[model samples]
Target: MSSGIALARLMFVVLGLVFIATASLRARPQSDVLIMRNGDRLTCEIKRLERGVLYASFDYVDGTVSINWAKVARVESRQLFIVQAEDGSVYEGALRTEEAPGKAPVRIEVLHPAQPARVFEQGRVVELHQTAESFWKRVSGNFDSGLIYTKGNDTTQYNLGVGLRLRRERWNGEVGFNSTLSKTAGVSASTRNESWVQAERLVGRKRWFYAGAARFLESAQQGINLQTTLGGGAGRYVKDSNSARFSVLAGLAYQKTQYEPASGSQNPPNAMAGLFAGNLQLFRFKKTALELSASALPVLTEAGRVRTYVNSSYSIQIVANLWFKISFYGNWDNRPPATFSGSDYGTSSNVSWTFH
Candidate 1:
């Protein structure tokens, strides 16, 4: 068989195995209970708690429903979970709420099978996720795509983005891919592609982390056939709350570039650089979300040369697990190969779907 065919078959087999494993892990009794501050009660399977929203699934509901975490007064669940507190403390166990008297503050309880139960005030708990034996059960991701065509100019543009995240008790992993293509009747096609994988581990319990990442990029506008980067650094969260998060990192990176032959490059192919980056996220419950990230790399081996990247996205929830998103990306290099552009930037609008 051709190598392409064999690769496709292998991918299918791997995906099938993952599906089976996830299905088995998700086969749990829908016996979890929630009590609301206004005395409303629900019996459903809890999915996760993120950004001040609690997600749950009911047998009669067509799709998952989101609840305001602040409005919840009590919870009971038998399934295991990994929970994070506002102070960055991590816990693993089943969940319950302590029964309190009228007008008293609610307290959450984490019940471990072997260890003593841990309790915290409801307001102190920040995040929660159901845990299972299968790795697939700890994975979440989203996909986005956009296309635009203009008949008068015979112009067409396409965009695609995919992201995956794996969450563990004290570590996390992420993978991302993005591509853009543009074609016009009488103009050369423009294309750009980017992919990256990153892993992060929590340090001492104060929102500090260490991370490592590898990134690859190709840009027609910049005359880059490919550029690769490997970097590692330590970072800390400047702000961590239900509504927003901000973090900054500083580290070192090594990068190599392969320029298009047409550019007649004279610069060196490799460089060592200092990396500085920051990321911010803001959420408005199920209504809207915003993300911004920026990175700057100052070349150590090549004097007076620096590279930068900026990305921003805004998403509005359209319905359950679906959103309308607008995104902007910009890449810049202070110095470049002869006759090549020093910067590339673009904007896109997409429909996105997320799953866990």
Candidate 2:
């Protein structure tokens, strides 16, 4: 009977310890705080800031909420984050807003435990990414697919695109694949495929970067079996902001082309070219986004020969990470093998999904 009483007392002690531990965890403060221009305040966990939107999670809320960056008045967070500015400067640290009088421009302070603190204008900050323990959490990508059918000609067409990006403190990498196939009654099928890999490294505390890329293409319409290009160059951002970004690059490239037998070029020639390219991106909060890219390759080995490429896309968010996209692509070569077409252009509408 005495041993039973001792066991009961021990059990009571264990229960008390568990209760104290649980209560301590529940009382811990939230990780971040946000203030709105309308005088509202929120205590929540900030996920990231991208494309003029700040994503956050609240304990009382059901899911992640997106707030417009322009509407934010202040923010404070102790969690480490990767912040990027319009001038191509990047910082990693905790974030806080400076106290300012009415009508004054907002400023953000980045405080690092081991490094000196830095300050930047709030409007000049373009992106923020939370530093996660898992590497996969730092990756983001999108996949899009489209289909078209016509009963009159018994024609069908399908297109698919996939892209993946990995961003780090000073560099980023991207991979992309796109394909289109079409079939029609009493007509031969046609196909086009393109794949590319690109990498960029930040140069300094300004809007400068170095980029390298490799691309492969196959097009039945252009009578090309395969075309491969390798290039590297330096680029600068002309404009970088929440609503728009524009950049240009100039480089040198080498291209090797293999023509189909019917094109009558048994021995295909390789050429070295000068590359000029530009990219533009525009965003409208959560509503819409547009991207445009163009490149020109002037063959140095063969004078007067040129190749050009153009790609443009407009996307409207339907809900959350799902979007409706309309895209156009064009490829042109001023000179081609005998009997081969010199251009291929097409348009597609697709449904796309994005994830981070």
Candidate 3:
């Protein structure tokens, strides 16, 4: 066979794999079905509802269940959308537009721009949605898992994640779980688990630009000592780097950590704060691109009296599906008193394995 013909066949094989993967990622169980407004019932799993489109998963024998949000007068669901807190707690109720003031730390009420704005002298009211308990049941078990390894230090880590999204017409509210484990020599093997969720509004003609993500992170670290933190970040992206538009993002996070030695109770909470440096990427070349970013998180206590450190990272993409990343990390422990000797740096390179 000619080299040209062989190359064509290879491309076809890759493309076929890609399509199969996409289909699998989107496929759902046959039992999923949703009924829309106008008394019309459909047989499909709702993929996602964004803008006016209600994406669904349907099978031949199961029938079709798809509905547009605008056309949806009301939803008939054996399931609904609900929000779960980072504490592994679940809240079951209906979405409401008005929440009583000065009652809860997180006040959730449905967003209303048309409702006359009113100021409460008592407290603040945050918009939130109300849904049924079963909503959480239907969307359960959609989780992801993976493992990552570092060759230089022979370090390996595993991760598990669960994600959820709440759709309004053009906007979505999301939340989920993220947990990880790492093992290496010299460094005490550790595991960190974080649960976070975010909300973003779709903007632009094609809804390609995800305005931003308001994410929360609640994590615990285990090793010789156990430590935990509650933190979060907000991120946004600009679409179409080839154009004049350069997307930039800024974020801030705070964490309270307590360390408990195996034999004793937890230590007092220490403050950890992070600041968004910046990110810029230009995708001009078909197979090449340039991206730069820097973010720093520092232990926010007095340098000498309190254990402190700053973690930072930077990365650049050299070729299609390939990139290099560098991370700088440091930490201090005050218990030993004035022992400032501690810092580390690491780098990683990733290559794409595009089976699809």
Q: Scored by CA lDDT, what does every candidate get?
A: 0.87, 0.84, 0.37
State the RMSD for candidate 3.
17.0
What lDDT is reached at residue 57 by model 2? 77
Q: Which has the greatest lDDT?
A: 1
What C-alpha RMSD separates each model from the true structure?
3.3, 14.5, 17.0
Per-residue lDDT of model 3, residues 1-356, tens digit only? 63223333433443443344344443335443443335576655544332233445466634223344434333322333332221211222322223335433323332234443222111121111333233332231223445678789998876544445544434555555444457886887654433444555534423132433332222223221323334444444443322112334444445444333342434345555544434554432223334554444544553433433333333343432233433333343444312222222222233322111
Q: Can you tell me which runs of candidate 2 are displaced by over 4 Å? A: 1-30, 59-63
TM-scores for all predictions: 0.92, 0.88, 0.35
Off by over 4 Å in 3: 1-142, 147-158, 182-189, 200-236, 240-252, 262-268, 272-274, 277-295, 298-356
lDDT of 3 at 84: 25
Candidate numbers, best lDDT first, in rank order: 1, 2, 3
- Better-scoring candidate (lDDT), 2 or 3: 2
Give candidate 3's error at residue 338 in angstroms. 7.3
Please give the RMSD of candidate 1 to the true structure: 3.3
What is candidate 1's local distance difference test score? Answer: 0.87
